[model samples]
Target chain A: MYKKSRARYFFLMPGVVWILAFTFFPLIFSLYLSFTNANMRNFTQATWNLVGFQNYASIGSDLRVGETVVTSLYLTVGSTLLTLTLGTFLAWLFNHDLPGLRIFRSILTMPLFAAPIALGFMGLILFNETSGSINSIIRGLGGTGVRWMTDSWSARTAVLLLDTWQWSPFVFVIILAAMQSIPEELYEAARLDTGSGWAVFRSITFPLIAPALGTVALLRLVETFKILDIPFSMLGGGPGSATQTYSYYVYITGLRNFNMGYASALAYILVIIAIIISTVYFWRVRARFE
Target chain B: MATLKKEAVMQPVRAVQIGRSPLARILLWVAVLMAVIWVLYPFVWAVITSFKTQREALEPTIVPFLQFQPSAENWSAELGLGARETTLALGNSIAISIGATVLATVLGTLTGYALARFRYGIGNRNIVSWVLSQRFLPPVATLIPFFLVLQRLQMIDTVPGLILVNTTFTLPFAILIMRDFFADFPDEIEEAALVDGANPLQIFLRVALPLATPAITAAAIICFAFAWNEYLFASVIAPKDAKPYTFLVASTSTVRGVHFGYLATRMLIAITLPVVLSLFVQRYIVRGLSLGAVKG
Candidate 1:
């Protein structure tokens, strides 16, 4: 019923123009910077050169780069698994009606909105080997205190635990919302026919919410790959690069080491990986949606 | 079990399990209680630690009066008048978050309205998918280039620069959310408005926008929270003067040492605003967090 008018451009042009100028232009510039020999000390035109493929070539030989990739993958996959399991379990638990459940829901999901950097710092305090509360409780129970910060595997576990603590709520809230959206009559009917909760869930509830679960899971997967703030705040990629994510490494290469070319190259590699995963994500989601 | 069955309409999936044995019910409650403790213990511990002295902080003290004496020393040191950097960082965070939220919301809402209500043919589909694709773009990919561009423009270490960068990342979310809200809105009212001799912009301002207040507010809140929680852009682009509280949350240590009490104080400060704001918009948060995929 709405008329076709040119004035729609009035609404669309400003945002489109802003994104093109800010986001698109910077990305194209970054792609160009990835091939050049640009460092912070001589970032100006006089010293920079458009050296083709040198930065990308060195990526093949750089062992630390490979290690960072493995680290990034491990953290991403591990945290995704941890978050999905905990979040889905919580979602299922919260699906029940109990006294004070609403308040519990609020309290449980609070971590999703809290600043990750601060939460990471909180992890440091909570996971401290000798004096932290977790180890203290463990020791009080007659167990040995863990070396969470100093040990390599323990440090990675610390980072994963902190990330899962913060992000499981994202999965929980999304999955719960999806679960709650299902019609009650379906479960009631299933129960009358089967007279079993597990049968009702498997027949009715699980299939309906599987797509939503997939959406949230893939979202978490892509996001966890860009895990920087947590490890940056908690360990600063310590214990000799135990918890250094790809994004953290990129940040170090670009800003800390001032190697803009190599950093841009590293960043592009991540961009490519993100693109592949998200492409698969979109394909799966769209197929399900269709 | 009969009462739970009666309540099944409200919690269908879970209430179906009411026929379980008493022991199973007890075990279920135990699991729920443990989950609650897992979720809340850190924040509770943080509150406890914030009140302790540095010496008390070193110990695994749980209670305030029994195990350790709580003091306001950390609070005073962190928020006192002498804490110039802390206060400035707080101001910078507030300004930058609000600034970016406002800009992104205004532009995104207008654009979203166009996409939702008007037909730009295949361009609409392309624009929607392209905007969604922008969310997948890693921030690190653009980090160096933004640093360079902002540096050349002399906008580095400035509030406006940080705001611009934050707005860029958050604009896609705002657009998608506003578009979802606008698309779901019934067209009959707008059709009546058009028949009443009103233009599209006039209809939007007088009719549609007021109805969309909750959505616009939700979009703005999510944007503000994201910009407030943002650390990467602010770390690189606004290091010196426009340093945010998120950055300073990590920089609380001095030549003295890493003060757990002091760091806890800053962490609480950094998170309190977003946590409180999320409470007010709890219903709309699901849609926002899920990028409008779930109709929460």
Candidate 2:
């Protein structure tokens, strides 16, 4: 038993070391970088002065920060609501035993596994303003084609639509799992008592699955707030930065403009927001286990 | 009044009958068909676009034979021997994803087993919780530090550099999943091995590890898919020679204009691996996505 207990550290040490070296160290370094004027030009020189919250101070005046935050909120809330609604509806439909239902369910969840950025690139072709299939469909119906990428609101909508398309399946999968976990007897009893499908669902199925749905919703909230790949790939933060997300703006500042210090500051702000959201998520997750 | 109330309560059960009436069934089927189309239309569009010429690709054509003639020009351009960059990027993706998956699986399995089976003096719940929180860290937050660190090590734009980064990002998923699996695993097997004079390490290697193959594979495949689909780190740290297929797919628009046909081909390449692999791990996917908090 002594030998067994000691082996536990043997198992744990390597992962702990790797995390400290890779995850923890980089996070600490980023925190430090946020306080210094660490520009790409100075990086090679290996010299940077400690700026001490100047980077944070500049954030108040930086219009880009405010704009990206607003854009991110829109993308996050819009996509999350759309995905949840579609996913819940699909899950409810899938809960039924129809012929070839497995095949249809598999087909519907395909987008969940596809790379988001790749899908975003495909979104470009699909939502293309001219000679695009979507526009063609609109024109076929005798309505003028919408400018999907050129217009700011339209570009934001394009991003939201693509995000929803990719993630709704994920919500579907999670919600479906939750729905299936409900005992068959519970629904059977509810049906016998109420003699109404909607009543049975409201009294039994919904209450049981609500927690799982909440968890999935919170998960999507955190994920959507970190939306970068789609906007980056699809529009390049385009239509004059209208589609720029918080992460997109941070990437631009840190990597593109080579303003590492300010970028780190922006990143820290995101971290704070993420931490707040994740705390709620962790609380919910813990509530279930406890 | 009481009899009328009783009738009123019973009326909705008949009037609002769900999924039973012929019209309702037809409507349900139509909704299901539309849902499938909504999910699949993008991939269909991309496939069709890949077989198009630049001019044809720019034009909206749903049908290949009727609306336009399908061509293989884009495929040749992307996959031909002359297309060294595209092929090389694809190779990088495979190499880096596999490398990270192998490393993460080993580390995560060991750590997860230890947490699940042993009482480490520190609170195991806290440790597991901390590990779960790592998944929430924004990639952009770590981008600069890793870039600078890798640049100092002179490892920028290298496959190994990317393998290291991808492993870090995906390690949390692996650990949380394996921990959940190991927690649910029966200890009688290990207990029997212990009676036979095998240490925990020996049991983990000879008994537990062998028995846990399915769980391990699920964790590994999930890790591989994440690393495969990764873009930000690949583009930032490994922009030159080590750029993955994801980077290539996203950057398809180049000088002159986007050859829509080529873009479509690359998108197809980037998505095919995960979509195919997803079929194998369908049962475990929700467990993976929810960090094993919700079992599928």
Candidate 3:
């Protein structure tokens, strides 16, 4: 039995080592680097200064930092809600016994598979102020074209809209699968009770799939918070930093500005926020299960 | 007696009537159509934009199709099959993504099987949670340290470096999905194989592996898609020799005097592999997503 236990440890060794060296090690090292004033110009032989809590302090007081955080939070929350609502509605629609339903589901999920950077460029072209297809459609509908990438509000909306368009299909697929798994007998019983369509849904479908919905929502929230590629590639966080998400801000600081230490601090804060939000969401989910 | 007969007659009629209201049918069709347009219009735009000349792309038009003379010059230039530099980048992306997926799948399967079969002293719940949390850590936070570590090891700007970095992100997901799949299998089969006097390795290879082929295939497809789509790490770790097609599409627009048509074509080409892969594995992809998101 002891030998068998030892063999199991041996089986686990390679994966554990890989994670330790790659994942955990880098995580700890980055946490330590957040305190020092590291940058590209003074990268080598740079004396590390232990300015405890100063980096964290600066994050709160800095106006630019605060604005970026608010913008990121807004983008994350707005996109999450939009995708969840829209995706749920689509899932419900496709869930019905309609003809060509499989084909519709497949078509709807195509965007999820497209490369993010490619989709970003596509968004840029489609939402471009003067020459975009969207604007052209608006003009055809007797409204003037909107400045999607140039104006602040519109730019933020563009990012949120693009993200929702791309990711809602993910939620739709998952929720649809969960809906299919529900037992038909439950719905039959509700029907026997002379339940209306709305009541049947409320009493049966919604409760049964709440856990799946919660999981999808939590995953989306976490992903949206870290979104960098689409907004960065599309708007470049331009028109006065209007669309600058936290991840993009970190990119600019670390890579563009070469402020590794401050960027590390920012990254840590982002991680903390992600952990807290996910934890809260998961706690609620756990409560539901119990 | 008349009242009871009336109630009985009304119930079924009401149920049938509620099922297919004209308003409900119209709303459902509208919702489905809207979703289809939302997801597909951009891709259609990319296709149309790819065909237009540079000047045509700049001009606004209400027509749903291309207004200018379509050309293939942009497609040829963007694909880089005619040029050395661009072709090299495309090759590098294909090699790295494929390598990373194969490595991740192999290692993930081994680890997954161990967790499934061994039932080690460490609580199974802890192991599962740890695997899931691996994905929760943002790659940006760990970028700098990974960069420094790779640089010190002299692995940056190499295919191996990109593979190593991608594996960190991909392995956890592969393990999580694969473990769920393995758990769904019956342990009785393995016990029966053991009773036949086969060694552990032989049993896994000859019996369990064949049984888990569908799941393993699904996990592989998911990992491949992820590695192919990954951008930030690929951009930072591979500046020159090891840059992928995604980095190519990103950097092309920034280059001065580059044509928009050519850029659009490049974007289209870059998306081709992933789109094809996704279409091929659409069913498995759905399965994997359900397993990952809807915990049993």
Candidate 4:
């Protein structure tokens, strides 16, 4: 029995060891670091005390921290919903083999290949108020420039749009795969029986693809929680901290402010929030997937 | 049975789609055109801007090459015969991506094979989910410890350091995709090999691995792309020589002065590799991205 198990152990060893050293170790160590003064200032000293609960306590008192959570939630929820709606719509629209299916799908995936930071840069330049091409066209038509970066609503909109636009393709690809897998007979039968498009889609397509939809939503939600590059690069999470995402907050806390302990705590908070949301979301669909 | 039915039904559907009902096909094509426009417009502008002079980048042209003069100045400036930073960053990016890909694929394939073929105790199912959840841990959670740890080891600003971090993030997806791949592998073939006196490892290495080429290619490309496009950890960990193009792209745009043309040049350079690979393996990505969760 031991010999029989040996091969499996051998195969699993590297990944398990790597995960332990990198993921689990960092996770536990970060928890420890969150309780102590582990910033750059204290690094050379080679010593620091346990300032227990101080980091966690500070998270509540910092108004920006609270606002940043709200900002993250808003983006996470907003982007997930928008990406889902638009992506599902696009997926269904492109479900049929039309002209240039190959070309359109390929082009749609182009942004997904580009770095998020590059996309952020693209967002930065394209959404620029004055020199922006969007405004350039508007101005050419003799209209005033819209404050895309300066105004809060428009700033958030720009961030949301970028987030949604870049990610909607992900949703489309997933849902389209799901939709493709649904047997055509079911669709054909539904079509023959039901005259309305809504009836066929609702009864046959939507129900069949619900689990895939759930998976897409869950994945998108978790990913959107960690959104940093686009909003940070596009707006620096500002126009008065309007778009300061949760991960960006933790980034500033650790990297910028040198608040290692607090940032570690903030990271835990982010993880905990993600865990809860994903767990709740997964509970509903877990059985269905299996 | 199903394929035959599908082909039969699709025959008429195709006829209706293109020949009989021109309006619906045109409408579908129009919707597709709008989406394609949305995806490509920014990239198109970036390309046009890359060719424009610094002056032309600021100026809006209704028609590229007509309203403004097109020059290779930006591309030349950043990507010319002797450009060092861009070249170095590209080299570092390639090293890190390839390094991470090799590590992730080799280790992940084994682990994925084991998970797919064997069953542990009660925790059998939780393992995949547990590993996948690793990605959800905000990079900041690991960044601080990674920073401190690497600083102690004096491995900071090194390509190896960047590769290790990239490997960590890419491994889960690698494992999951490979697990999905191996799960989808023909059990009958492996069983037949087992009956022919091949041990599991031999069967895996000799039989399963050969059959998993599509998945392996997909896994390799996905891993490579993830590492190639990684920015946050790359920027924080690699301060100087080892920083990848993604980090340079961000820093050059935000911290340093904007040579808008140079920026566009970097953008085009940065996207070329992943874009090319993705286009080449476009089918694999959809499967890889969904972990083959979607049936098709």
Per-candidate TM equals 0.94, 0.94, 0.90, 0.92
Model 1 alpha-carbon drift over 4 Å, by segment: A1-3, A42-47, A193-196, A284-290, B1-17, B20-24, B254-256
DockQ ranking from best to worst? 1, 4, 2, 3
Model 1 lDDT, residue A273, Cα: 76
Q: How close is candidate 1 to the true structure, as a TM-score?
A: 0.94
- Going through the candidates in order, what is chain B's TM-score? 0.91, 0.91, 0.87, 0.89
Superposition error at B108 for model 4 (Å): 0.7
Instruction: Residues A1-290, candidate 4: write the lDDT tens digits.
Output: 32245677777778989999998998888889889876776544223569999988888888788788778888889999999999998888877866556667777777777788887777777877877798887888999888888887788778888888888998888888778777777867866786776787789889988988988887888888889988876677888888888899889888877778888988998778767865665454333222
Docking quality (DockQ) for each candidate: 0.56, 0.48, 0.40, 0.52
Please list all clashing residue pairs in model 3, or write none if there are none. none
Candidate 4 positional error at B173, Å: 1.5
lDDT of 4 at A130: 70
Q: Rank the candidates by TM-score, best first.
A: 2, 1, 4, 3
Ten-residue stretch with the least lDDT total in model 1 chain A = A281-290
Say which prediction, candidate 2 or candidate 3, comes out ahead on DockQ: 2
Model 3 scores what on Cα lDDT? 0.75
TM-scores of chain A in all candidate models = 0.92, 0.93, 0.90, 0.89
Better candidate number, 1 or 4, judged by lDDT:
1
- Name the lDDT value of residue A70 in candidate 1: 80
Taken over the whole model, the C-alpha lDDT of each candidate is 0.83, 0.84, 0.75, 0.78
